[model samples]
Target: MTTLPTRTDKKLGLVIDLDICVGCHACVTSCKEWNTGGYSAPLTDYDPYGADPDGAWLNRVHTYEIANDHFTGTVHFPRSCLHCEDAACVTVCPTGASYKRAEDGIVLVNPDTCIGCKLCSWACPYGAREYDHDQGVMKKCTLCVDRIYNETLPEEDRTPACVRACPTGARAFGDLGDPDSTVSQSVNDRGGFDLMAEMGYKPVNKYLPPRKGTDRAPVTNVAPAPEQTGSPIEKLFAWADRALSR
Candidate 1:
C-alpha cells in the first residue's frame, strides 16, 4: 500500500462557483482537447466512430433542478477530482503508481508503473478516476500539472485548461493553503465548502452554493416546453449561455 505525505507546502486546487456555471461543458471540451495530447497523451477512444463510442474524459458537468425557500432553479454542477489531502486512491495503490505531490498537493498517477489493477479507481469516492480500456490504466484530472508550471506558455495560459475555458468565469485555481490568496478570500466571502467533509478525505476543492435572492424565480416541478426552432444540442448550449444572465 502507498502512503500520503504528512503535509504539503502548498495546496493548489479549484474553487467552483455553482451560481455562475451554466452547464455549457466548455470546460469539459477544453479539458479533453488539452489532456488528450498533453501529459496523459491519447486519452483513448474505443470504437469512437462506431455506434458504441466511448472515451476517457477528465472533466464532466451535471445539471440539477434545485429548490428551497431562498432560491430555486437549475444549477450546473461540474465534477472532477477533488485531490483530497488524504487521498484514498494514492494510499490504496499496490504498485505505488498513484501518489500525491508534496510540493503542491496534486494527486497523480504514474502510468508507466501502473499495472491496470483499477485499485485506485475503486478507492476514489468522488468517481473521479476513469479507466482507459486501450491503455489499461487509471486516469483522472492532473490539475494540468504540465501546464501550470510551464515557462514557455504565456503566464495567463498556464492554469488548467478547464479553468481557462469556462465561459462564465465560474472556476478559479490557486493555492488554497495561503490565507491571503485570492482564492482563499473568495472562499471566505462566498462561504465555499467541502464536497463531503464527513467522509474525512479532506478534499482540497471547494464549491460555492447558489446565492439566495428575491430575484430568483419560484420553484417549479413542471418542465418548460421545448423551443422548436433549434436542435436539442443547440438549445442546450444556447440555454447554458443565457442561464447566468438572470
Candidate 2:
C-alpha cells in the first residue's frame, strides 16, 4: 500500500479583518478558556473579583478611534503572537526550547528543554511570550498544533479556538506559505497590512484595513444661520443716515 500525504510541511497563519470585527472579545475569552484547560499550563490570574486583576492572555483586542479631515474611523485591533519569520524569541532560547519548525515554520516551545530563563520574553517586542510560572517555563501560542492534527475532533474544528470562537468571522487560519490559500487570497484582494512592519519581524498575522470615513455621522448639527435681526442701534444708525441724506 502507498502512503498518503499528511497535512504537514505547511506554515499556517491568520488574517484578521478589523473592519467587520464587532469588538465582542469572544476570541480573547475563548483563547483563555482553551489554553487554561488543555495546554501544559493554564494562564494564572493574580486576583479574581478583587480590587485589581492580572493574568496571562495570549490575545487581546484593542480599540482605536481615528479622526482626520479626509477620513474618520473606529478600528478594533485583536493583538496576539505575530509568530514572526525572523523570530528573535527562537534565537535567544539558551536551552533550545523556543525553536521554529523548518517544515511548517511555526514557532513552538518544548517544555522539556526549557530552563525558565526570562530572556525570550524580552527579545520579543510584541509581548507575545507568557511566563508559565507553574511549569517553570515560558508558554505561547502553539498555533493549536494539537487540535489541528487531532483525528478525534471534527474536521471543521481543526483550527485554533480563537479563530473558531470569533462571532464576527473576522479571523482566518490557513497555510501562509501556500500562495493559493484563502488567507493569502484575502490579503491580496483587500490589501492587508502588517503591524510594526518596519521592525522587519515579518509577522505571520495580517490585518485588514479599517472601513474608510465611517467613524462619525454627517455634520447635521451645524449652527443655524443668525436669524434675520436688526438691533435697535443698527436701526437708529440707519435712520440717522437716511435723515442726513435728506
Candidate 3:
C-alpha cells in the first residue's frame, strides 16, 4: 500500500482564477451538495420555498459592477473562508474544535469536538463558516481533505467538488508552497490580489484580478470635406459628406 506523505509545513492553498470564472454558481451548488451529504450534518435549507428562504453555505459568489469614466463591466467575486494563516476563528473556539492543520494549513472544525458555539463565525470576516443546527456544530470548507487522501477514489477525482465542478475552471487546488506550481505561477504572472487586504487575514487563497482591454485602441475625428466648386451633383456629394461627419 502506498502511504500518503503528511502535509508538513504550510502547504499553502489556492489561486482562484477570476478571469476564467463565468459566475455559473456551479461551485456553490456543488459545495452545498458535497458538504450536505459527506459531513456529520449536510447543509440544510429553511423554508426553501417560503417567503424568505435561507440556508447555511460555506461559500458564495457575489457580483459587482465596477466602472471608470471610459469603461463599464461586472466583476464576479466568489467569497469563501480564506483559511487565514492567523485565523482568529481557531483562537476564538473555546472547545478547541476549530483548528488549523499544521501540515497543510487548512482551517477545519471537528464536529466531534465542537460545542455548537458560533464564536468562529463571529471571528470570520468573510462569513465562510456556517452553523449546522442539526448537529449543533460549525461547518466550513475542509478543502476535501477526506476525499483527497482517500485511496478508493481515483487520483484525478480527489479534489474538492467545488474545484471539480467549476465549469469555467476558475478554481485550482494544489500546494501553494511550491513556487513552480501552476497556482503560484498564475499568482506571480498575473499579479493576484487579496480582498480586504487591510484586514491582515493573510488568506491562503489568492484571487486573480479581472482583465480589461488594451489602451492602444484610440478614437479620432475624421477630416472635413474641401469646399465644393463643381456641378450641383458634385456639390451635393460634398454636402452629404459634411452632414454625415457632423
Best model per lDDT: 1
Tens digits of per-residue lDDT for model 2, 137-244: 887887777777779999998899899999889999988778899999999888899888888877888888865653555767788876756999878987999999
The numbered model that scores best in TM-score is 1
In angstroms, the error of model 3 at 224 is 12
Q: For candidate 3, lDDT tens digit of each residue in 41-156?
A: 57777888999988788789988887876446777777887778767788888877888887888888888889988988998888888887766788898887776777899988
Evaluation by lDDT, superior candidate among 1 and 2: 1
- Model 1, range 1-246, lDDT digits (tens) per residue? 268999999999999999899999999989999999988777998898999989999899999999898778899999999999989999989998899999999999888888989988888888898999899888899999999999999999999999999989999999999999989999999999998798899999999989986556687689899757778898898899899676
Worst 10 residues of 2 by lDDT: 1-10
Clash pairs detected, candidate 3: 36-42, 36-43
- Model 2 compared with the native: what TM-score? 0.80
- Where in model 3 is the C-alpha error above 4 Å? 1-8, 68-71, 215-246
Regions of candidate 1 where Cα sits further than 4 Å from its true position: 215-246
Q: In candidate 2, which residue pairs clash?
A: none
Error of 1 at 37 (Å): 0.7
What is model 1's C-alpha RMSD?
A: 10.8
Estimate candidate 3's alpha-carbon lDDT, on a 0 to 1 scale: 0.79
TM-score of each: 0.86, 0.80, 0.80
